[model samples]
Target: MSRNQQIWLGELIRCWKALAPADDNTRKTLAGLVGFAWQPPVDQREPEATPAPEPELPPPVAPSAAPPQPMTQKPKEPPPNPQASELPRVAIEEEAQLQAAEWDSVEVLNPPQPHNRQYNNLLPPLFRPLWSRTIVTTLASRRLPIGFVDAERLVSTMAAARPVERIPRQPRWTTMKGVQLLLDKTPGMAPFLSDQAALAALFDDCVGGEALERLHFFDSPLRGVVIGGKKAAYRPPQPGVPVVAVTDLGLGAPESHFNRAAPGEWLSLVQLLAARDSTLTILLPWPAAAADPGLQRCTAIVEWDRSTSATLVRRLLERICG
Candidate 1:
C-alpha cells in the first residue's frame, strides 16, 4: 500500500491484463495485481432471426382448359398430268425397225424327198384328194402313174392351199384352158404365177440331163396329139408343145380311142423311149373287171419343139446349179 508498491502493482496488473487470454491463472493474477475491481465476461448473448410463412397456391387445371387442336398437316402432292403419257417416237420407231430387220423369209418346197422328206407322205392321210392314191404305167414300163399322180396332186393341193378359180364342174377336155383362164383373170395372180413358175423351175433344175432322158414321151409331129386311143385327143395349138387327155370311161374297146392314137405317130421306138418329145400321152382309169387294160396297148405320140425343150432344160440347169 505504499506509493511504490501501488505503482508496482499497477504495472503488474497492466501486464496481467495484456496476458489475461493466455490462461486462467493469468486472469487471477490480473485481478490480484490490479488495485481497482474488474470482472470477466461469463455468458454469450444469442443472435435474433425471423422467417416469413409461405402463401397458399391455386390447384392445377384439367385437360379441358387446353385449346382445341386440328389434325397434323400432310405433305403436299405433285400435280397430275393433263395429257396421257405415251412412248417416245424414237423408241416406237426403233422397235418397228428392229422387228422389220429381224423378219424371216423361209419358203416351203414340195414333192418331198423320200428319206430326208419334209412331209410325212405324198398326201395328208386324213383329208386327201382323189388322185393321191392313183398310179399308172405306160406300155414300155415307163411310170406315167407317178407323173399323173404328182401333177394332179400338185394342181389340186395348190388350188386348196390358196384361193383359186373354182369351176362348178371341172371337165376333162377343158382343164388346161381353165388353168389359162385362171392365170389370165385372177386378182393378185402375179405372186401365185411367179411362185408356180419358180416351183416348176426348181423341179426342172433338179433333173440332170440323164434324168431328163428318163422321162417318157410319145414322139409325134402334129398341132396336137390324141390320147387314150380314138376316144380322146388333146392338141396343143403350138408346134412342139405337149397336151394331156384322159380316156372316155364309156369306151369299151380294149384300146380305147381316147387312150391311144395321134397325128405323126412315126417316131422310132427309141426316141419315144428317150422321153425327149414335148407331147406326152398316158392312160388313167382302172380297167373294169370284165375288161383288163394292159400297157402294151397304151401308147403316146409326143410332139417336140427343140427350142422349147432346150429352154426348159436350160432353166432346169440354172436351178440345179443354185
Candidate 2:
C-alpha cells in the first residue's frame, strides 16, 4: 500500500474506534470490516499443557515449641482450552464510546461497489424478419432475359406459321446473379460485429451459403488482403455480380484515426465495379450525403441502420435496375 493509503487507514481505524457508530448498516459494515482487519485483541492460542513442576528438595525445618505447621501447598490450575472462544466485537471496548453511542451516534459510509451496469446493443436490427429475399433482390444483379418474347414483338412476328408449341413470356428484368458481400473488418467497425452476423445470416438464407460469398477487408477493398489463410490481390467477383459492401467509409472515425478509407479509395473501387458492369450497394451507418457527392452518384448508398426499411431497399433495386 502507498504511504497515503496507510495513513488514511490509520486515521480511519482511530476515528471509527472513537465514534463506535452503528446507527445504520453502512456504519455497521465499516465497523465490522475495520475490526476484522486490525483485530487489536485477536484471540491468542492456548498451549496444551504446562511443563511439569520440578521436584523440590525438602526444606530445613527450625525446631519450634509447637510442631512445625504442616507444609502448606497451593493447588495447580489447569491451562485454559484453546477451543473456548469469544465472538469478534466491532464496538470499541472504551467505556466512553459505549456511553456516547447510547446517546445516539451518527452513521456514515463509503461508496459501495457498483452492483449494476448500463446495457446497450451496439447494432439494432435493420431489416425485419422474413424479409431476406427483399434484401437479396436489392443487392442481386438484374439482366434482360433471353429465350422469351415481348408481347409487342410477338404480335409483329406475323407469318402466323409459327406453331404455338412453347408459350413465350414477355422479356423482363430478372434478379439472376449471385451476391458478393464485402463486410468491413477494420477496428472502426468493431461495434457492428453483431450487426455483421445478422446480415450474414440473412444473406445466407436468401442465396444459401454456397451462392453467397463474403469477403473481409481491413480498411479498403482495393488493397491486398488474406482470405482463408491465402493472401490474394484484391479483386471483385465476376462481371455482372452485385457487390453489397457494409462500410462506414471512414465517416465514423475520429480525427486521430488515420487508418481509414478515404473518398478517393472508395472511388477507385466504384470505377472498378463500373468497368465490370456490376452494381455497388454501400450499407453505411451514416447517410449517403455524408460521402462525396460524386462517389454517391456512382454507388447506391443505403444507411445500414435501424431506420432502413423495405421501401428503402426497393429504391436501391430501382437505382440498380436503371
Q: For this target, which candidate reaches the highest TM-score against the unseen true structure?
A: 2
**Root-mean-square deviation per candidate:** 52.6, 23.1
For residues 150-267, write the lDDT of model 2, one tens digit per residue: 6654665545766555555654544557778888877667788777777776677656667788888878888855678675678888887888888888777667888887788888
Task: Quote model 1's TM-score.
Answer: 0.17
Superposed model 2: Cα runs more than 4 Å off: 1-123, 130-133, 141-143, 146-148, 153-175
Model 1, residue 14: C-alpha shift (Å): 99
- The alpha-carbon deviation from the true structure for residue 247 of candidate 1, after best TM-score superposition, in angstroms, is 2.2
RMSD after Cα superposition, model 2: 23.1
Instruction: Report the Cα lDDT for residue 289, model 2.
Output: 81
lDDT of each: 0.30, 0.64
